[model samples]
Target: MIIIVFHIDSQERTYIERITQDTAEGIKTLLKNDLEKRITSLSEQSKLSVISSGMSQSDWDAISKNLYGTQYGYQAIGWIDSTFHVRKRIPKHNNEVTIDFNLALNPPALLTAIKAQDTQQRAVTMPLAFIHGDEGIGIHIPIFNANTRGNKLDGFISGVLLFKPYIKSVVPDFLLNEYYFTLFIDGHKVYSDQSNQPAIAYAWSKSSSYYLQGHEWEINVSPNDEFLYIAHYKVMRILIALGLFITFIIVLAAYTYLFARSKLKDERYKIEHLLKNLPGMAYHSSNTINRPMILVSDGCENLTGYSRAEFKKNRMLWRKIIHEDDFKRVEKSLNEAFKVNSPFELEYRIITKNSSIKLVWEKGGPVSSIFNGEIIIEGFINDITSIKEAEADLISSYAFSDAVVNSVVEAVITIDQHGLIQSFNFAAQVMFGYSADEVKNKNITILMPTPFCDQHDQHLAQYLKTKQTHIIGVGRELIAKRRDGTQFPIHLSVSEIQNHENTMFVGLIRDITKQRASEEQARLHTEQLAHAERVNALGEMAAGIAHEINQPLTAISLFSQTAKNFCEKGKLEKLPSIFEKLSLHSRRAGAVIERMQLMTKKGQRSKEVIDCIFMIKEVINLAESEARLRNITIRMTACDEAVDVFVDRVQIEQVILNLLRNGMEAMQLNTCDNGSKIELEIKLNEDKNVEISVTDTGAGLAQEMRERLFKPFSSTKENGTGIGLSISKSIIEEHGGHINFCDNKPTGAIFMFTLPIYEKRSRE
Candidate 1:
């Protein structure tokens, strides 16, 4: 009896030890999982709040309050700035003391924060005493500047984890009552449910270790007095009582057999209960054509919406529930597994009794039933519908993003912090003459030319280090190289993308080669049109120029003849005066010829600063002869101060001349009873710009004519080419000026134009 009692006690002790070990392991897992979730939530919040460069106090307050509201077991949640100052704390009624508190005073917390920044990862500090006299550990998650290129630490999202409340929340209620648990962090006892209880030297106890954030955590679990009495002493006393009631040998044999059978039944019951409560279904099935299930857990109803009895009664029901598209593959896998007597795992779709589809993952192996010595299948089937759905959603999102990027006309390229190409859209591939695969993972400098390619890395490094931007978020026209070793102009605009892991730069690029070509073509066409109009204007003024030149030539002829006659008649004294008149007349003719030549010259338009008054005077001189011949009196109004303007001399002169000639022609046609007159005025307007006006005493323009006045191919005169006014408008606009015509006070037309005043810096 003593030997039997000793053996029974030994068995009880073994079972108790096993249970404690499992409990300790469970507690450790729960703590680790809970801590991980909190860390992840804090990290995500940190990322969101720093999107605008730095987090405001209100931002921190909102984030901390939200976290505190959603979760429990935190003594306090707060934000710490880069300077180690605690800027904001939640549950402010009690935690106000922590506000503005510098973390530098707490060596452990400060070290943890520094470690988090250095590793760019979340970290936890050693156990410490909280201000409220609670024992806890601090967790720090580093926040970084999202706009910057590097992982520059902006601050930390920190939380104080109260050991007692935290551990109570994680450990199941049933476990707390049955077992005494003690938690240790780095060999320091931080929490214990029963402080008076003996340590690990006790017979029924187990210990497990968990590593988190550089801290070694240990959980020791031991059975309480009630559990110890039930598991060990009670069973031993009952067996001893039974041994005393019967003959020694018979009682010994009966007790041994009954105890073995009872233990077997209890173990079986435990396994069955565990399987029934599992999150997924477990099954034992016969290896037959339809794979009829011999046993199925209660979880069958939850997972498949069918009872275990239904699965057993209808052998073909399980086979029918498999999705049509996936049944064949499932069967093939099972058949292969049976052939090799090996385990098999598969993921496939199934339809529940309610006709709802689900994705399930199954793991099974062939097993021989002990009762009948027949091969059977034992397996676990878990519903994985949510996981599969999440995967599909992620894939669809990526596909949609890719479609949008590739469809854009502008090339899209993304590069990592090191300037290595990460993504190359279809447009980028076509623009750069390289395949997506060829450019992926290559340095962005590969698509740049000589100096840019050489300096690209240094520029990127500098931006990352200093967070100073030159081209990021700004557009620039730069040279880019193609796979064919050709360089072309490209307009590039870069933007930064930041996440917890790293920084990325997205560039929108346009190949401006064709755009540049088109602009050059338009410029050349404009120059041609202006030159053509200048020549045409000279043609129209041919008669006026000839008459003006004739006067100067005739005067020279008369002077020279007089000089010769005086010399012949011995009038030497008057000869010097005649020679002087001759020289003056010759110079007058030469000046007219030079001005005409300048007007006819055609070349690229070059702008320079010149006095507006002087330019207008030259135009009047050329038009004066024509004005007089047409019975028109020309008048001038001048400003006392010189008005300087930046303009092409020839272009401005052409515009002025065209307006003067038009005024003369308008008056000639009207033939007013009062002698016709044209007024030319140059003065500064309110805007400090040079304003030139020409007024003609003729019939003013009609409403319809004014609307299309500046348009090409529209004119009001009888023998007009219709291009003079259009060319004049273009010339004025090109020189940063505008021309418009308005009605004169009484039966006349007034044409006014304004030119921007040139500053000295503009000439440079």
Candidate 2:
């Protein structure tokens, strides 16, 4: 018995060892594949940089900025002069500084490749070190000028790599911790990972060397013994127990043989009885239902709640036992089986003696009757009532899921792994103007335009190969084609689900055509309202602007007449001075009218960074004549300082003019006994914002008027369009500012607004 058990144990051990060896080999292959793939990718990227350097100067200039340090590793590229001085560096230095390649190159990495100057286009790697205070690993690919046949190397496309991240990214930390590993490049120890005082020792190891891009990497690794022990511990115990049980059974074999002869007869009789009393009904009946069954088993009691005697007497036709709905199905199945002489199997419902329905599966075929030599139906019936109940519940759930798909407003579509449409819901049918039957088995590209349609298959095929997805599990805005060939913007979100053997994608799409149209209309309406406000402001100040221009015209006329008089009296010597005065006033009148024309220009608003103080001073100059006519003295409290804001200059000027004119009118409505004053003030606030305020001395605004002052179409003046203050509020807010009301110190309303200071960030 001991010898027998020993043989079994040896066989099991051999099989287990073969499986363990296979697993270890598989792990080694996977690791080697990863290392080679990553290194090959890095080598290809270096060559691409060399290619870009040869293309054009602009492409070369942008190399450093485009380098992905976090994704790939730290890197740099430069152009070197014949003197070995770095002439251009990507991700430029903070200040003008030169890198002397003569000192930066160590014993033999980049220096050897540069000095070789051969046309073979080889790559060299340099160790990490600080050259002028920056530490990095450099890989130099020599760039030779393409214009000349044997031109000297122009420069190098350098790769600065972070060692630890670059190495572990290809072979992760988990792999390092699980196995003992050492890596060498060019006979130098680049990285070595091993656990000291490991739980188990390494009993075996594997070593390999790979050469890539003229560089050699040697790798040695060994599996962890403790992990292998834990993996096989329970399996060994199970096999040992099985071997012991088999040995015990072998020892009892002789004793069991002696008792078997005596008990065989009695057991045969019992087995015969058991065979006749199986669960489910068995029957042999004639082809005609009116004939009595040739033989029926006792299981008819459980199957139909009727005795075998009732079926043998032909008291009821076997066809009448089938449920009403399933009568035709059962007859059809039997007819097909008889015609082909094949096995008959069917699932249908039957009515029991108590009028209760029980789902049953019947299986058998036509056989020759042993007594009469006539064909007969021989079959067994199994009660499948529970299975039928489960099917009913599943059908109910399918109905609920269909209801949900039909209720959604957005189009929902499902596609198979081949990009063929599998399910198109009601919304999708309506959106694409195609029914589910029309689009079924069609590729999803039919609903998309050129570039998207062409690239979709490529994207899907790549994902199937690499298991990497960019558009799946995200929402993207794209253009979709309708049945009428019209293209419109749609928001689409796709999700992937993997079921058993196939993959499926579900996409939800929403049409955004109306939404985009509404946004454009709103923007156009805003521009039209701002232009109208500028025109209205110019209309209110027309008389004052006329007076302002007439004064300059009057001066020019007086100066010209004086100059002519002097010429007539033979006083040509004074003519030069008079002529100078005439020229000054002539230019001044032209300036006034030009400013007015700019303020009311009918066009789109243009935004730029302008000095806020200078613009306010200009508005003040434009409104002085009107203020003086109303007996209001306009004063600038702090107009000399410089503050910059980004805004539409003309629109901002109109806002300032409207406020000053509104203040002057308010003062006139409630006349001040000591004369009215409109003062303009600007100050830089603690929050780095420009605050401008217009104050007037008059009867203050009523509590009721203050609440609705900025609301559209609510105004204090009868002739006012009621949109000026509202439009002013919109303009200021659009420029990243807010305008509102404040109480003046001496009992009047002050209109105050704040604007963000312009910040220059293009360089930073």
Candidate 3:
């Protein structure tokens, strides 16, 4: 792994360069450990010098205040005791100060007085000065002031007579021991033992008297001579105790050595006795000799049915006892141990006197010349026939599992956690249209569609963390992308297998595309049959009703023409009577034809993009005669411009005509209605499809007939054909649209159909 640091604003890069040109040799030289050792030595040296000097009790406070310019503060460097102590070393003009300031406790400093000339070691002194007062006043301050307000004779009495005579009799009581000197210059510490170099020094003086009334000091000489005599007495005592301790240790070691030797001999005797009576073979060999020889114990004869005399002198006899197939393996095992200077263990077969193969477990290790005068291999062999048979049974179990997987009808594929394809059964090859050789080591995402390819790794990571999987232990139907780039639906079942630390998944997939296609085709056929029935029933109703009403309609038209002709010829006196007769017949004939037209429209294809207003006007004109005969008026309100659509123009025109006729029949049948009228409206829809609604004010469909009204052969009228709505349904659906019917407010039914307006693509 490499660490690359880049500045986000400037894109400037810096690399941690590996400048150790002899990197391989540096690794072999253990350079990191060596560097760590050197750093530890420097840290220890700094610690030892500070601890030995007692700077806390002397002038550390004065030195720190002058040098660091702090009355009291601490700097943490490293551990001083179990708890880490902040050791502050302050360098002054001529000497440095060392202080252990542990803030956890209200702490004090260890002080050492350093003479400027000697800066390497601290000077040790004892009981330098003593002064006393009545309470806290003179405990830690100067002795006195020099000037006094008094007469000359009175000053002489206080100074020369009283204080001056008392000062002449004072001296120090204690001595200074092992005094060494140190100095500091320009923040660097220099010691007296280092060199006789130019440096500042401070010396201590013994004051005889303080004139504070009988205060005294005395300094002792010959301090080192007295200390050396005391150290010699302590050393003699320590040597006598150490001599006793060494004598005790020597006695204990000699007793333990003899006891351990005796116990080891007993163990060796027990092992040799056990080997003689063991059920299997035991032997030792010396490979270090010019010619290696095998020493066979008596138990070897029992295992191989060969006398030890025959094998001991002849190493070839040992090979003869091994089965022919096992001899090469035994030789290989021995050669490997000698090559690596390690141990050897193997299981193979040997031949006994009964002419049967016996499984043997053998283990050996190299040893120095102890049992013999040469380096040797010593081992024991055991019969392992039972274990060999158990292993054979395990192999048979795996073979059965393999057979079951191959026999399955669905495609099966196995992939490891890394998504590398591990195994693909024969059925999988055929289902994916890939040969086994082509897919091995390929990513499983080859079978996934685009977005799935991008998101599959994220899905794997989520499942691994949560231990939740959507596809495992359950079957799902999903689309699988094939090698040919075509997609088909499949039912896939996945199972996860974890062995040791490795995770794998097995997917069993079966193609279901053909089955779904067959079901869809059947559904469409059923719909067509229902539509055919509706059309046939409506045709029969229209034919029957139209045939019965046609003669009456012709008679009404003839009488109306005759009355109009007489009126035009100036027969005014007879006009009112004839006109009344003409009107009654005309109204009755219009009602009969209106019923016929509603049920009798036939299917015909009409393709056009006719203006919506014009189409509605033409259909209204065709239904006008029928409407007039029933005293029912037809109304139309259409958009000024044409709203065109791609459609079978004739069929839709017929549909409009049928709706007008149905509307006239509905309004004429209701005697209580104020106006006998039908309205047709055409308008553009928001989605660019044209909606045509034909609403009637006729009596609405009966509750029983409403549910089944558009079904094949279902009708409410005695002379009704039930095929109109069903046929209309088929026509609209064929144009990629739909038709629906709803109750028209307080009465009648509203039939509505939508067709998309045609959009033409421009040529490039």
| Overall lDDT per candidate, in order of appearance | 0.86, 0.75, 0.55
**TM per candidate:** 0.47, 0.52, 0.34
Top-scoring candidate (TM-score): 2
Candidate 2 has an lDDT of 0.75
lDDT of 2 by residue, 317-413 (tens): 6788888899887888888999999988899998999999998998999999888898999988879998888999999998999899989999999
Displacement of residue 362 (Cα, Å) in model 2 is 3.9
Q: Which tens-of-lDDT digit does each residue in 199-296 have in candidate 3?
A: 21111111111111122122111213333334333444455667788999999999999999799889988987988888777877666422234776
Number of residue pairs clashing in candidate 1, backbone atoms closer than 3 angstroms, sequence gap of 3 or more or interchain: 0
lDDT, residue 48, candidate 1 = 65
* Pick by TM-score: 1 or 3, better one: 1
Give candidate 2's error at residue 570 in angstroms. 26
The worst-scoring run of ten residues by lDDT in candidate 3 lies at: 152-161
Q: Which pairs of residues have clashing backbones in candidate 1?
A: none
Model 1 Cα shift for residue 440 (angstroms): 3.1
- Residue runs of model 3 more than 4 Å from their true location after superposition: 1-321, 328-347, 352-356, 361-366, 371-373, 378-391, 526-764
Please give the distance, in angstroms, between residue 758's alpha carbon in candidate 1 and its true position after superposition.
2.3
